[model samples]
Target: MDTLCFHDGNITDLIESRTLDVRYDINHNLQMHSSLIRRLSQERELEGHLGCVNAVAWNSKGSLLISGSDDTRINIWSYSSRELLHSIETGHSANIFCTKFVPETSDELVVSGAGDAEVRLFNLSRLKGRGPEENAISPSGVFQCHSKRVKKLAVEVGNPNVVWSASEDGTLRQHDFREGASCPPGGSSRQECRNVLLDLRCGAKKSLADPPKQSLALKSCDISSTRPHLLLVGGSDAFARLYDRRMLPPLSSCRKKLSPPPCVNYFCPMHLSDHGRSSLHLTHVTFSPNGEEVLLSYSGEHVYLMDVNHAGGSAMQYTSADASKVMSFAPIVNGVELQSSASSGFPSGSLKSNVAATLDKCRKLVQIAEKSLKEGTNYFHGIEACNEVLDGHGRLIGPMLMHECLCIRAALLLKRKWKNDAHMAIRDCHRARRIDSSSFRALYLLSEALSQVSSMIFIVIGYLAIYDWQHDAKMTY
Candidate 1:
């Protein structure tokens, strides 16, 4: 028999997927750190699920661990006994997209969203320790949050009752649990019940496009602790948009609109990379707990970090000099030095030095372009100024130039109604792909530009056909 081995840090444990329900810790570190620790594992291999486990969340007091799956089931596990506590079967008809444990609550309240266009809340406290009872683990309430699949979820750091969700529908919604009563009587309309129990409305007006057909769906979002009411959403857009939740309509129009001022002074749109002709679709976007900076993980092995304060109209970008794929990033608190072999080859000193030099040059070029544009000088001169920066450091500045050029070309085509040029611009985004095929931003932009161009072409053809038919009718008469 081939034995399976499990090893993490100073711990090692193994289990046969098909066998027993026994839970044991082969290593002693968990026992040593018992005050704030727990562990669990999936003993049985769920047969029908198609994908591997994506994420795991622990309830406030670490009592339950909610596991979201591509299998479309949210499995609630008991942390103490490491047993499969409960399985919430409804709410999401498609792949169980995202599951979050609402903070500051003793009740096992888990919120989940799926590809089926719904967000559901399960009050697991009502069914805690009840193994699969007929009604146990079912959703206590549901919110038809988005018109498309919900892809990511985040709970406000300062307030647990406030939750935010991102979806393929191109919208992010904020849910306020403080506004309503919990667990209304059965048979109440889901919409009515949700409106009563949870105030669900679009938190931000920013939208996200779907990823390339060849890539995985967007699955990244994060909230800022330092900047309350500011939510960061990342998707196929390659860029992340930060919105002041307070400015969102419905909520902004509500009585709470007069609440205290928000922590975030202002948020500007920031681009992650300037590479690839196609917009690099970002798989995930995250901010440091301090809200001083942000990071993005794009498809095609690109990971970047940006100082949010420096992300202005001028292009800002950072790439790992050694080129290792950064899957994700967690906050670095205190002065602890946590180094990884992943970034070992890339010297931080050199990387920062190069970035500063490149940014300085780009800034100068931008200033010149702005001056020319403002002075009513030839637009080509401004273009030429930008082109000079692009030519000298194309490899280092290609990503930014591509974005700037696309914006310029897109604006021109939109104004001229030249649908083919816009379509060609998107197709040419493939140039970015050649530089970095895994860039989610490029993939996303290409897809969006393609969609827009396709729609415009269809409408133009329809109008021309109608015009020709009218002309023919007049001649026949």
Candidate 2:
């Protein structure tokens, strides 16, 4: 913080009139830590998976978390108990890529797709208790259609029978399980059938005259939360294409008669605006919970956020379907000044220019962090950026920047929603409160963090009480 005193006449006159208070207010308002160890503050990594984890999903009420790994195993865990409820050794010979709990199944069924190009189901209802890993247990049902790796799986709300899979063979197919899984007596699981929902190769062909020969391997797919018919399929290209499933060609339409799928909207970053950016492909694309926005992640590139509602020119021009207005959370690794801070009103000292330099540095970092929060995806990276601001500013950061940094971190940690994230967020709030006694944001974040922790604390206390009561009963007997 820079301080300047305005004197109407001379320094002697100003001194005689009054002594400027350098830090009286700040010093008086500064607070101290609680001085107790944060026992509840923690970070946990469930070490159940032997290989790289590829997919995870929460069951209907979010009471259970299921993870699929390259080890060909799936682990079902209870979030409340923080324990593994079941582990299934999927007999697939290849790496599992995508997994999700089937909707409206009461978390009884989970579907997974693997590099073997097969989508299969695991019946959690049959795998009772947290027993040892069951070996070679046959899948409840199987989907055998694609010829390449299955990279993504999507499920529609209120429909347990419909599951969508995207594959490296350039096909997005829908599998129906209702006919087989809801078996009439001892009906065979072979009754399940798969339909070619969207052949990426045929739908991507520009026109009927252009041969549908070129194929791009799909990497991810998602269904909009609000509108079930709106779907997204992202793959080995710079753009993630959105389509309304209702407009897709009929099931009876042969490959020769199928027309190009009319793209609802295109999401691409300005940096990779054209098809020439084939080197940059999307690793993942997902819709916002409210279904008004989309988040696209490019392989080895910064994630981009776009609001589809505000994209340019809804007047359907498929050839130049461009929506490049995107916000990115790219970090400035080098000390690069893309723009001058002259207009930002930061103090500039003619004698010592270091103050202005320092302020600009922290300001840019803070801006990057705030942008990530506003983007509403990749909160972890935002927290990392906020950390750099606090650490790179040395042991004594300016009160203004420190307070801002703390608030940014608190907001990010809360958004991240990782294990014990609330405790850390609460600490950041306290630090911000110490820096600024009248900070409304700090108080607000504290309350939000406390609300999350309160329930968690109650659960922990209940478990402890149960243990104590059981011990007392054993001793009395």
Candidate 3:
């Protein structure tokens, strides 16, 4: 049943297909992400690169190979024929770092980045009758965003219009070509990037006199194939970083002021043990196709595999200080505050932690809140922790955390069943709704609170009739 081929873009057709009965969608997704790296036995050598090959990528089907090299050339190779299909000059005066075929373009579109800091796009569909004009291998699009060498290019599987780049300039940026697609050809309307995803240099600007120990150069990056929002970044540091892109500040505000680092956790084996003195640096980091495991390649060390949960251990959760700069918690990353790893990825371990440990104050209060909630004995500490965040950060506290606290407090108020407690829960629910209007939990809890108050019994009955009863049981707080 899993062997069935459902139409890619037509979800409705897939749902109506025979594969739907056997959970083909889920199984197929899982099969695509298996982290297992089978030992390499097959070798097929096709040489064309004059200088060393810095980056290579396969098309969506893994049929053809694309190689970018220091020779300032891009080569396309046919696996079966063992022939160099195309050897085009990239027009890059410096070394090339990465190149990829834009997804869903039938392998006709290519994007590449080099040490020259330019992101160029080629529409291979242009190779209809003849090669591009001699020495005029003009790109279809050109983007100059990073001031320093661009190290990596990441394109999401389903989104072909957008491209991501990490640079030695200490910035992670995004380029969306969807808007540029409409512009007329060869005019001044060239596609360029201005979207700053994570600007590590923002914090370093104020401390220019006292330079950072690490160069802050981002070496490699990969978007989680399973969880699209999770971005894995490895740089010139011992620690490999994991970021929930949603926690970063909006582009507008980030440009106006210094935005706190959105690093959810650090993954480092040395940090967890007494090997803090080790000069660890990550060369690359990847999530298994399933996004269930993380693989970290150290500069001069062995590879280590980590379960996503334990890679960044649960002990290093972010505090209100880091929370205030952004709009929400990286809830997915909250599973572990500091996952232990042999070489790469996640939370408050060792060297990376030393750089921004100033946010440590917010951790203890949260731990107390968690302990209190787990004991089921007292809601005081939990509620107090929320209040402290609200009081300390006020409007700056992330709305996601605010919503979480409001719900938690409201749930606890309902459990107490004290006079006017139901009313208070309703108030919290209203507040949570204002922060995030679409929350089903808040809406459901509001109905439950209304059911408790004698005056709103009829209203509660109406809500009960309309709402789904599937989430009816237990106070989640």
Work out how many backbone clashes candidate 2 has.
Answer: 0
Across residues 129-221, which tens digit of lDDT does each residue of candidate 1 receive? 466434445566666635568778888654657667676644455667766424332233443333211122222212122222322233566
Candidate 2 per-residue C-alpha lDDT over 24-46 given as tens digits, one digit per residue, 9 for 90 to 100 = 23221222112123234665667
- Cα RMSD (angstroms) for every candidate in the order listed: 18.2, 21.0, 23.2
The lDDT of each candidate is 0.52, 0.69, 0.63
Residue 277 miss distance in model 1 (angstroms): 4.3
Per-residue lDDT of model 3, residues 228-280, tens digit only: 88988877655566789888776521233244374766554422221232345
List the pairs of residues colliding in candidate 2.
Answer: none
Residue 334, model 2, lDDT: 41
lDDT of 1 at 130: 66
**Full ranking by TM-score:** 2, 3, 1
Return the lDDT, model 3, position 310.
47
TM-score of 1: 0.45
Candidate 2 global CA lDDT score: 0.69
**For candidate 2, what is the TM-score?**
0.56
**TM-score comparison, 1 vs 2, better candidate:** 2
